[model samples]
Target: MSWQLYEKARGLLSEEFGGIKKSFGGKITIALCYPNTYQIGMSNLGFQKIYYLLNQHDDVLCERVFLPFPKDEFSFKKKNIPLFSLESQTPVHNFDILCLSVTFEADYINILKILNLSHIPLKCKDRSEKHPFVLMGGICATFNPEPLSDFIDIFFIGEGDEAIDEFVDAVRCFSLAINKGKDGFYKRLSTIDGIYIPSAYDVTYKDSGAIEMVLPKNGFPQKIKRRWVKDLNKTPTSSKIITSNTVFGDMFLIEVERGCGKHCRFCLAGYSYRPVRNYSAEVILKEVSEGLRHRKKIGLIGSAICDSPYIDEICDGIAKMGGTISVSSLRLDRLSKKLVDLLSVSGHRTATIAPEAGSERLRRVINKETSDDEILDAVQFMTSAGLTDFKLYFLIGLPTETDDDIDAIINLTKRIKHSILKIAKSKGHLGNITLSVNPFIPKPFTPYQWERMEDTKSLNSKIKMIKSGLKGVSNINIIHELPKWSFVQALLSRGDRRVGELLYKCCELNGDWFKTFRETNINPDFYIYRERDFNEVLPWDHIDSGIRKNYLIKEARKSKEEKTTLPCPEVGECRRCGDLGCVMNI
Candidate 1:
């Protein structure tokens, strides 16, 4: 209703290159909401892809809405203006459906804020036919939707490429049922695979605060199987909207792969997105040719991009088309001179690598498999290819980590710096080595789900140790995430529905989580600092990710013994993880 806010939305729409703006007449309107600022949400490729896919339907008109900037939030509150979509500046509450694309657990509080701003009911049970159905999807929702079950009406699990079509049909059926005053609206949606209606399920907990059982109601499926696009080429995931208002604004992005074959014990992405699939070089080149028309630089996206077999061909095609290429990071063991040289030619001065663990012994515990010698060699190769600066990522509180491993981080970084300096001296240039360190947070469906997170005090001490060890070293920068936030992240990652109450209360206090914990009877440590038994029922047990529980138990045991597992073979029946169906179909 505020003209000032309406003007702001129009200003942003003017800057975008490719965005859908359509008449809402006779259309299934959807407000694609992202619970983050415009700059952060616009940078996400997944969010952009969904918007593109939804608008491709003739009857569907999807618009974008984001959390207001911090300074602008005051005006929104002062003027009592509801949140509006960017394309048409329509009120979000007027849309037929409010689909939330949630990727991080930290943004759970913001979802409540967005709903309150839009004048919508915070709880799903309180919303009626007049209110827009609140649906959610993304990586966080796929693994565990229980924590947000009370708020969302429907959840789309796994990849959204094919699931979106199925959801549209279900929504149509529900709309007809609503007009007839029928009670089977949810039951109609339950028939689709990967569509979870949380209201149709019941969860009971034991006296010890562990989940006892999760039962389905009204003949719903016992387990909701995750759905994924079997073939990567069928769905072309590239940037649909190009604007200079994002993190990687200067480059056009394309997804080269879907999942990682490397089975890292602490990784949720590696386990949840099983049976790794890659986009063919022909498809990638075709995308690059189209993307080059908008931007001169092409950004390749994937879990392990350098491990793709068509890496050289894709880079070569981009080069021949006079387009430079950029990747988020490279695998240490897969680094090649040709790839590094191509990156240098693309005007890239810094190369990023994630060793994850500092010591080789600790790396084995996490199943990283890459040796310290191999990491140093990769750095040497990059420096020789004219890369001056380097960014190294490591986790401080990994399982089985000791003070010796902390010392190893310092020693390994210094060795990498020495390697770079030896090459830089000949070129008369000195480059800085940056280290990004963070505390480890266990995620659901991973081998570390049952493990306890290190206490904040000990994690702080380890961070201080790393800082003190490298204090006097020049041209070496250390940037570590706050330990307290990691504690909050861990609690949310492994929490049940009870934690959602705390999340709502925390939002009411304007994001003061510490005060919320003190006021509530819930013990945050019960979710963060406690290890679980193998027989316990997890909050996400009813959500089938196709990876068996027994396989995760076996992997957890292997982690304790400091054993390493080989990466998934390119094409074979891998029965090790009980994901043979996914592997064989690939």
Candidate 2:
């Protein structure tokens, strides 16, 4: 091991507040890895919560491993240093299990990089009894595990809060069996509620390269059901470790809720994370009180935080404790005067809102219910509360997008700029409005899953149109993601196990995806550019997200007709999506 690398880890550990270090004797060793840099991984609350939960087991000693920075990665490659955990500096391959928390498709390549650095076999078929079992979880894996199926031994389907404990128990029960071989242990884990053993299933494809069927082994279930925590109150997710080296370093993070009730047709989180659940104000305030003891700022985490019924009460309670607050983004339709005032008082100069589409017609197509008037009113409210700068998010190249829709975006942004300047001029101060534009990538399990992503050339042209239309406008700045990268994301998001082969080849070429495509027989465009028929089987058909496929089809039809589905009722027995009353119970 390199002394420089060991000392670097020790320095990071020294600065952290609540990291756990325990004896490895008689414990199940897990190297919880995040396939990114330390700065990015440490900022993720989900990764931290999993670390906290795994170590909560008296028999499980969990440590963190992250993708090394460029210079450190070079040191590992040149000096042949094995990847080690942050807490103990032990080689990751020495652990019994390597649990990867993957959140984005772009990080798929980084997973291979981490595995390579750790000296672990990149493919599950290549490993033996001596190799650590590879497990993956988080939103990306939960939605579609096929692309990584060849590399990962097991995939945990849903929220890790309760399911992880069950997984650990299974591991402990099958400890002796694991020494024999992974086959029997894999079969045993296949019986768990949320566990999916990829090797235990066989995927067949048609001549046209579409999935014919996904069949499980005789003992395994035909479909793997996603497990979720029934009660957010019981499982209070908060920052277990505090460090000064993260993005939200100055704040204590807490999860106030999970899942979104608004069924935006294009959103993966909305479809996959069904049945919205919120922590009661009492629970949030108690967590806040504890958080205030450590940091003056509290970061509230959730998909629909402002939609919580007790949002006002929670904000007021935090303010009463002399703690400031921050959130990822705000819901335009749900903004309130009290919330805006609290944010302004907390010294928030910038706020973000996602209008998604510019035209009201396109908004209906995506089921983003906020109208143009509501968007302007939200801007007015925030500016009146003393928040100076604003970030507006929009998507280009959506399904059925037209030139008029692109023009609408430019026109809408101009109106927002006008509104901001009207407020700033009177206050004798100027504020900027930034447009964060991105290409629309089709994701699995959503209504748009079967739709084709617009070509990169077309997407880039639309982006240019927006930039050109708003050229020379004062105090208005624009930024966008490269359409080419979004195309790659679309390919990975909707790809099958065959895509795994392409991924391996890409890694061998040092992430030259273009060269990987040119050298391989697999066609990347087939995955992203072709629209699928409703009768065809999808890559993720075997993974049951509880919302029926038929329900998704129905929603797709509604989108075609420019119709909007109502939000899931807070108190009702409606089973529109066939979730079996998960909404009412929550």
Clashes per prediction? Answer: 0, 0
Model 1 spans with C-alpha error above 4 angstroms = 178-183, 583-586
- Determine which window of 10 residues in candidate 1 has minimal summed lDDT: 174-183
Error of 1 at 387 (Å): 1.3
Q: Which residue runs does candidate 2 get wrong by more than 4 Å?
A: 177-179, 584-586
Candidate 2, residues 464-551, lDDT tens digits: the string is 9999999999888999999988988998899999999999999999999999999999998999999999999999888888888998
Clashes of 1: 0
Question: Residue-wise lDDT of candidate 1 within 351-442, one digit each (tens)?
Answer: 99999889999999999999888988888888888888999999988988999999999999999999989997787778789999999998
Q: What TM-score quantifies how close candidate 1 is to the native fold?
A: 0.98
Candidates' C-alpha lDDT: 0.88, 0.89
List the pairs of residues colliding in candidate 2.
none
Q: Which ten residues in a row have the lowest lDDT in candidate 2?
A: 577-586
